[model samples]
Target: TEGLVMAKNSSAADQLELIALAVRGNVSLALAARAVRSAVEAGEYEAIARALADQAGRNDPLQPRDRALAATVAAELSRLGSKAAPLWQVAREAWELERSAWWLAYALFREAEALLSAAGKRDAARDVLVRARSIARLLEAAPLLAEIDALAGRGRVDLGSPSPQLLDPVPDRKLPISDREMEVLVLIAKGLTNKEIASELFISERTAAHHVGHIFDKLGVSNRVEAASVAHQAGVLVEDT
Candidate 1:
């Protein structure tokens, strides 16, 4: 898969190509954006951001989906480059132009780390994040929903409606870690952040962070990168847990 390939270290040119695809409104804009962010130099991001803004400007009145993608591309590009604050504002207007669920949620779902890491931009992140999460709910994209919830970190976000059937059954077992905690650990070992783990488990970010702290205490590892290596070495995240 292109996503799996992007997950591994790839050349800057390959990542830039992905960015180009995303800028041109390709379906995997989130994955491509992430690949570019991870692989390309910071200086290159501005050029890509400009390309996204330009692509977003070419709205096709006949294709609502393409119009939606234009907005999504504008929104997705906000996560990159030093000019994010202004791009984020542009993205917000684009978001307001459409109300229904679309690929924008997919793009915003990938914005978790970047948005949350932006410090002073929490206000900006929140305004757009609310729309993104709502759209995710309408789309019934559970993983995307969870990612939004966990990253929101407020723990009180109204998830719109419950869809218990869509979620994996909460496993039950006896071990140093609860089944839920174990599940979090497995996701962690799989390179999911606490936010992504929370999304995957349909839990709160605060809860996810707490579970991770406990997992670290139990496993005697200090950080998630270390936790992944240690868990693999000890077979702690084995299947059929």
Candidate 2:
């Protein structure tokens, strides 16, 4: 449906209204999924997360792609501290429903990401990344391959090679902060609060907080002072532009 496009620049209330209407009217599952995505992209977390979990968990049939997408979104929201659904259960269900599909690979990538972030789950994440890598190569999907490889490097997962050349992830960077995280780190070094960081970077405050959490984890710090000290020592704390 054209509802997603129409909701693109819409207010939060309008987007939520359209989604509620779609759900109540029994619109196409795919259309409702698109509406959910649009709302998520606009940073509507609480209501969107609740609605997504309800639809995805309902007994209705879901297409393979939509199933994986729902899982992916749920996992990301879970990472941001939403109480919608458990990440492991959601991710596993998405792949179990459609093994050996491109969408499964994407969901697995997200699963690996969520696992990698959790304590004591690096081994599981590595295993999931290996599976995702195999599918990416099978599909000859250069982009997905690159994404998985980069993630593997960051997570320090040594995905064993078939022919060795098939898994050429870039070497783990000495400093593992991503480009966007680098931007956030710089802002953090300047003592910006999460809301201030969001305003400066044009991202949702929730996303800004997520980035800060990742930054702290990657830098092995609990607070901004420690994070900034580590960055300065690592020479990643150049003057903020």
Q: List the residue pairs that clash in candidate 1.
A: 146-199
C-alpha local distance difference test of each model: 0.59, 0.68
Q: What are the TM-scores, per candidate, against the unseen true structure?
A: 0.42, 0.49
Backbone clashes (count) for model 1: 1
Against the true structure, candidate 2 reaches a TM-score of 0.49
lDDT of 1 by residue, 1-241 (tens): 3433563466787777655554444444454466456545565666666655655556522134444454455555555545455555555455446644455565554443345455465555666677788787788898787767765643222344442222144353223666556667778888888787775554667888999999899877899988778656655554532
Model 2 agreement with the true structure over 1-241: per-residue lDDT tens digits: 3455556678999987766654543465666578778877887765565566566666654555455566666666665554423554576676677674776677678778766656577788888889888888899998888888867755557898532221223364366778778768767877889998775554668989999999999878999998877666666554422
Best prediction by TM-score? 2
Q: How many clashing pairs per prediction, in order?
A: 1, 0
Quality of model 1 by C-alpha lDDT: 0.59
